[model samples]
Target: MQQAPAKDRIQLVDALRGFALLGIFLANILIFSGWEFLTDAGRAALADASAIDWQHRFHKFFVDGKFYTLFSMLFGAGFALQLERLTQRGADGLRIYRRRVLILLGIGLVHQWLIWDGDILVLYALMGLILPAFHRLSDRALLAWSALLIFAVPIAGVLTVNAAGWPPDAGLLALSERVAVALGAVNPQDGVTWLRRTDFDGWFSWVMSGPIYSWGIRLMSWRIFKVLGIMLLGMWIGRRVASGSLLNDRRLLWRVLAGGLLIGVPANVAYTYGKQWQTDWPSLIGTVPLALAYAAAFALAWPRAQRVLGIFSFPGRMALTNYLTQSIICILVFYGFGLGQVGYWPPAAFYTFALAVFLVQLLLSRWWLRHHAQGPMEALWRRGTYSGRVTRAAAPG
Candidate 1:
């Protein structure tokens, strides 16, 4: 990527943040569409070959898993930046980081149990809590740990799933299957579409149904090892960025960019087809490289794509607020707990709505950042995080 324009400002991170948010919206639309696979009737309803084929191909090959991993990288990098600042000032980095992460966990708990079940906040927060443990590791050690965690856990999981009579065999897999069953039984906010009973009742049911989907399925099937691994990998990348090692090594960056794509594209292709064989192995191995490829590609193209990247930078800067609000809007639009419009739109329509909302958010975020120092949620997080400490004036980012 080009120089960040200022010492403290890293606009490439913001662009990637915007990119990650778009991908997240796209991935979560399946839930907003009220897709259920538990019954023959529900499966039959979703069985339009023309409606699903292209969309499935697009998501499987491109949109699935990759962007979230990118987001994870940003998360780690952000923390690395903050910790460096704290350490330089002789501040208690762990306490400050812990408080901040705990606040994130609190927000995630509410988001997870009260709003939507598809929330990733809790997982990120939980993982953030353990991130500092890696702070002491050297660059090489950190990368090694990341690679070990990312690759090792998934292979172990798949093997366990397959090996009959293996100890703890299918424990995670079986639980995920059971959670899936429960998820399909519970209808989305009493199954209303294009209408509502009452706002109060709608909200009441929405709250009631939150945990059933969130904890029952989302948390149950949570891929802790993989996410943690990615986050750790992100932490290592963050260190590289903070150390200026990555930015200085243009040759290495291009090599990484080329290598990631060369390996990742084909790996994802295998993953797309691997589903037919009932395996997660391909995705477990492929998603990281694909995500790295996307980041490197964007960095390489940033100068040429400045106009588009500039547009994305607005939403990227206010990622936390934009991300949370997306869930709010989707719940209102699709779930019976609000306007009661579940299953009313096609896949493309759902994604289009998400894009339309994000476009509005992009404009609004641009306008908001013009005057305010930060987005609403981010401001609150900072205030809560540094409440008892002396703080500096906001940077002119």
Candidate 2:
């Protein structure tokens, strides 16, 4: 008997993803304005008595770290759904997946160099290359690997630094120095380099030639292991309960809520004060727990979210297009190729700009999806991979 088609592509997951996408914009607003907003000295410059203190505090408390964690969880859930479709096809899932990931790598490389400084698509694509290896692992094995990756990355980082006899605070100091130089008021050179990077060929060069041969491969390799672990966790959750069904599982929801609050709240506090206090270990520890708390909370809340976050579902359904469109809009607003407003706008203003972009995309996505089956990029990917021919025609909704 023929198995029925997958149910209209998991509505709640899409909504959660859309919700995550909005948060991602909040996380990225600073970077979108200019590269300087994220650096230490830039933040210090923006944190004066005349600066908008409440806004900064709000962003730090609500936007930082939280949204990225949300995005990663959605990525994990999406990866599981991909594996389900592939496995049912009885094909070489890994080989096909590798090709798709390579395409994504190509897309990300272009996006990173041409668009913004905080591009995570390249990282995601790189992670995709190795996720298939863990696709077949048992739940226990998957959990073990996830735990190892989470613990091993930072531990390994610290051990390697120690082995090299580097100063305990060397990395942080160097980063601080870079920021200081950039924000020194008279350092025109640093400002110029920063602008050129975001506006010209510098981004392309960095992605293509600069150190891709060095730590690039290693970073991608490690991220793969990390992402695979997350993907397995999502799969485990999905297999345990069907969509809309998890809402009734109050005991599980309570467990998730507790785990998230227990870890997430404290970690966030530490991440905030620890940075201010210049305590490296606290920041590192806090970041890890925060990542876990994110997964736990999302897994718990998804069932309850189905009704609350309907608007986000439309955008999430067309995530690829929406994501890419964000870059397009940012370039138009800030690049030399467009308005060239680098170093001109404040962090708070950047967020306002991001909000406008979000609203436009949200409306556009809703309208576009009403008439078509896939977002523009998603349609291209479908045709490119399956037909080996580029079909420009959009699919009907």
Candidate 3:
């Protein structure tokens, strides 16, 4: 809710966030549409197998988990930046952050239950608590821990999933299945009525299955390791940015750009074609490097591309509002309560929808920012964050 002056604002960060929002939409629409439910034959019939398969490769290479990685990094950077302001003002950053996280947790739960199951806010809120622990660490020590956290668990998980579909123990598998079954199955009859045709019964089915389908399979499956690590890495980068080490070193940026392209490209290519055991696991881990490549590429280009890419600052500025609105728009478009066209659209067509929606959001954001300083959700979050805090003059001398 606190607005920075235009001159002081970091346009590149906003641009990166805006870019990531678009990418997140592209990455997420697949699951939201229930597209995975399509039969192999059904998918083939919808489009030429080669064309559809190529689309899959395109997603894997450029889209897939990359945006979320960028988003998470930005989250860490934002937190670090806020801590600096809080420090200068002699405010307790941890206390303010705790309130902010709580507010986010409440909003995230509401979002998850009503709009979309693929919510990251709840997880971010949970992980934000852990960040204070790192705030006092030396830069080198922080980076070391960040690297270990980001790569170790995910790599191990991938290897485990590749060798055996994770939780390799028969007893554990059976227990998890029992828990999942107890939660319920996502038997939506078909993709058409899954959201549209559902009366109370249909709604109830999804609600019940949320634990298994949404939380268990979605969160516990792999996202935890990925999210936690990326956040830590983001925080580490945040510190560097705070100290001016990251932005000042063009050589470092070049190294990252080169490494991201040189290393990330082939890793993504392998990820696209390889099966679960061979390349799938590695691909998941590779998303981070590729995402970094994207950030570096954009940062390098932003100076030249400002007018063209600067447009991203709109949606990026009101990210939370826009993010939630995306789910609302999607629900209205694809669910039975609305249009119910969920899986009816092909991949290319879905991409068009995402782009169109984002464009509209951009225009709306522009209009809103012209009238008001903060997005509605952001305003509420800020109020909560600063609630009951003593004013500077009121503090002890």
Candidate 4:
């Protein structure tokens, strides 16, 4: 595997990644803290119900669906950068890229089975397989295809399901029943109960059994298309970055930032309220714009706020490690076998806790990079990609 030298690393991208990680942690903590599992009645029963209600609204509007999109785009950008470098070296880029992706898939599987059920790496790896096909497409073509996947497909599916009353087959229902049985839960309530009361063994068993069925459902629902579309957009951005146009184009950045905010803010508000009301259209339509706006805002601020934003680059540089570490830490904190503090804290407390955890991670990441070139998981990924012949590139500056 060809690694970018530390000097060549894009600090802005790393910072954006680091920033995305923070957002992801904030978002995931809802599930990790079991706040997501609480029923509307349960939430209403909280002593800080008013605060929780507003906090949740804020989260749904600003946090949910936005950071993951950013991260996916970054993944595509990384793919673009790697493919370009490989081609420049006249190597068999496709073969090497496939090997790298396969390794990532393996890592993702292990993570999903052993760590967190909300893992995105598996989906990223799965979606990544199709990215090579788009590599040869023009930038305009890439954007066009991305918009089709992101907007058209999902909208069509929603319309079809609503209009035709799509039904779950008996086999799918049986599989879900089997999954629940495997996790020692017979229904949604039982599942939440099991999640709250189970020991390490039971929890591990749930992780092993649940994600399989969950992934199947996601696939059936066509979530992969949205993810793929975002990745393609990332690839387009990466190409611009590689060409040195995106970094220098202040006017373009301003336009993107302005447009993203103007459109994204209201759309996300609609998405938030729509979700509360169980409407799907706003979320499907709003996620990409808000996510893009966030990216544009970050890019515009990076140059002026380097001293502050640059701190994020440490965690961003070892994002794989940080991401996995977050799952492990959250599991330990919230799962029954550990602290078992799930569903106890208010939304505000969880937000503070997420920030605290990320701060610690930032420090740990900085320290680890001082001695090693990359995070442990990244090292393992590189080794697997290179068939045990990995080179130790210097850490990002």
Candidate 5:
């Protein structure tokens, strides 16, 4: 299939991606600034403890799981777009898609290993591998599978674990410890201390060894199912877009927005403040609904706010470059190898910093796209995906 010309590109999707990137950065900055590692006592001692508390609450309610869900959905939607175009042309869609996913996997590995441990690219790449299997399913079947994977699997896992009174598996804990030692830490705390105080080498070790433990925990927690489920939902949305129903149906958008507000908001409130639940499952349950609400709201507003909201499309167009760039910049800003401002800034300061960085990125993206067809990383990814057969066409979101 030929690449979609610029005029045919979906600017709203790009704008939504840009919006998701901003939220992801805000969520990730907690870890990037090293504030996530602070002890209760350490946090209590901060001058802005009350403000930080409020910020954390805000994040739990609005930011934490929501943006990633949106991003995952977007990824799925993009996949649906590619599959539709390729199938129409009778191309080897599966082979090309697998190759594309592998390229993404390679990029994610580099980002995860050398830059930061909070990388989602690796997870997305792995999840993307499974999407092709569901491409031929009916829309109803796709949504059924999505709901089952997103809500049912994670809830069941949580219930099973709670019933069994089990902790994280011992072998996984042992592997984590070994990974710590490989990073020159005597213990987990030592690893944290080393990361904050040591130079580039120490930072490198921490990031390089991170995935072993992180992925292990993620699997044990059934996060993959959640991610895969969200992608499937996105795929359904993509199909809607392809059929011209997504944007044309104002009634559907309104219903989704109403559901998100009535259901999503209250669920997230309980997830954020209800201590009796004693589990994060509420957040998981609420994430998709709220994310859908956000998307619906954005879509409803897009026609009226096209000029203003269109600013986000710049960064959205080159989401990969912007995402990786955020990681690299934040690493230098907070890590010991650069400014070493980790754990020093209050929550407000970090939020401000994140916004400032995003603004810069937005401007840079606008300028870059004016000169080049895509962001540097996007160009590289497209080249790799098409193996030089396609040139100067819009890649999927």
Candidate 6:
């Protein structure tokens, strides 16, 4: 087999990635700024909804489950692309990918410690460890395992609830209350300070002193499984589209969306309805279907959206640098590390800030790419992968 040229990287796929990056940032702003716990009046636009504490309701309807699901699905696609390249070169793709995941694990740990505890990179790294093992499974097998694994944790949780019932385990409940209380006590303006303490002392304490018992039980639970399932779906999409086989398939694109909506909308709605039952089973069952819908919708969106959202391509091209930059900016704006405007900025305000960041990134990324081969992080990653073949890009003067 002829080796694929290095310059053959697809622009449309990068554009799609950038679009997913933007969606991720929008959903993440709430968690980044600590607005996830704020009162409805503190953020919502609707007066009646705010009065009734409709924050979760609104988030669920829009950002909550949707954007992150898109992001995770993209990761899966990315993995497939990577493996395809390695396989074409007759290299051990799994071995190479594991090294990369190890590197990511280290990066994620640093990110969580110095930046934010909500870092998904760490989760991705942990999940990536098991992914290469599933590379060759038939699509149906992949889908089945994806569904089963995604639901397993939540189902187990539901079963535990059935067995134990009511207000949670006494010991766990007490610990959760303590953690919640500490988190609640921090004023928004003190977010930067919170970051330092939590990222450092809090993280260290949890890693060293937290029970192995908890980790053992929850490590492969539903949340992790759902993400893994998404990654698997992404692998399928990446193999199909990133490989350039689907670009000319215009009819396939519409079919993708129609099928996704047919399956996704009803599944997501059913999942939402199940949530109203106030039990774990309904949510678990509902989430299983919604996960499938999310994968389909994203795959369907890409080829169709490319021509429409081509401009976002550059930012997606530099995703690593941009993702890290977001953390840096948040630390500067909300923490004592810089301006420390945490609690003062409501959730709605983050949307404005996010827009500003996006605009700046979109312009800067395009500008940088005009004069450079790759983003700084991509260059560094290349240097890591190729040994001495290339040098890291120097920081801008």
**lDDT score of residue 5 within candidate 2:** 26
Global Cα lDDT for candidate 3: 0.72
User: Would you list the C-alpha lDDT of every candidate in the order shown?
Assistant: 0.71, 0.59, 0.72, 0.79, 0.82, 0.62
lDDT, candidate 2, residue 358?
83
How far in Å is the alpha carbon of 246 misplaced in model 4? 0.9
Q: What TM-score, over all chains together, does every model reach?
A: 0.85, 0.76, 0.88, 0.91, 0.92, 0.75
Q: TM-score: which candidate is best?
A: 5
Candidate 3: clashing residue pairs, number: 2
Order of candidates by TM-score, top first? Answer: 5, 4, 3, 1, 2, 6
Winner by lDDT: 5
Residue 239 CA displacement from its true place in model 1, Å: 1.4
Write one digit per residue (lDDT tens) for candidate 2, span 20-105.
78878876656556643345565556555346455555555566655555666566556666655565665555556666677777
lDDT of 2: 0.59
Candidate 1 C-alpha lDDT tens digits along 1-397:
5544434237777887898989888888777766422233543465565566666667887888888888888888888877887777777777888888999999988887677766788889988998999888887887888887778866776676458545332244344334433544233433432123345544554454544445444322235666787888888778777776675567777887888888788878876662432136557667788888888878777767867776888899899899889989987776655666666566667777878999999999999999998899999988888776343322112
Q: Where's the lowest-lDDT run of ten residues in candidate 6? A: 388-397
Scored against the true structure, residue 178 in model 3 reaches a CA lDDT of 48
Lowest lDDT 10-mer window, candidate 3?
388-397
Residue-level error in angstroms, candidate 2, position 151: 2.8
Clashes of each: 0, 1, 2, 0, 0, 9
For candidate 4, lDDT tens digit of each residue in 1-397? 2333333348889999999999999988988988877877676666465796588688878887889889999999989987877777666677778888988899888888778877889999988999999999999999999999888987887677668876423145457557656656545444446677655556755686667655755655557888899999999988888767776787888888888778777877876553452226667777778888888888778767888989999999999999999999988888888788877777778889999999999999999999998899888887777663322221122
Residue 109 lDDT in candidate 2: 76
Looking at model 2, residue 382 earns an lDDT score of 62
Q: After superposition, how far is residue 27 of candidate 6 from its true place, in Å?
A: 1.6
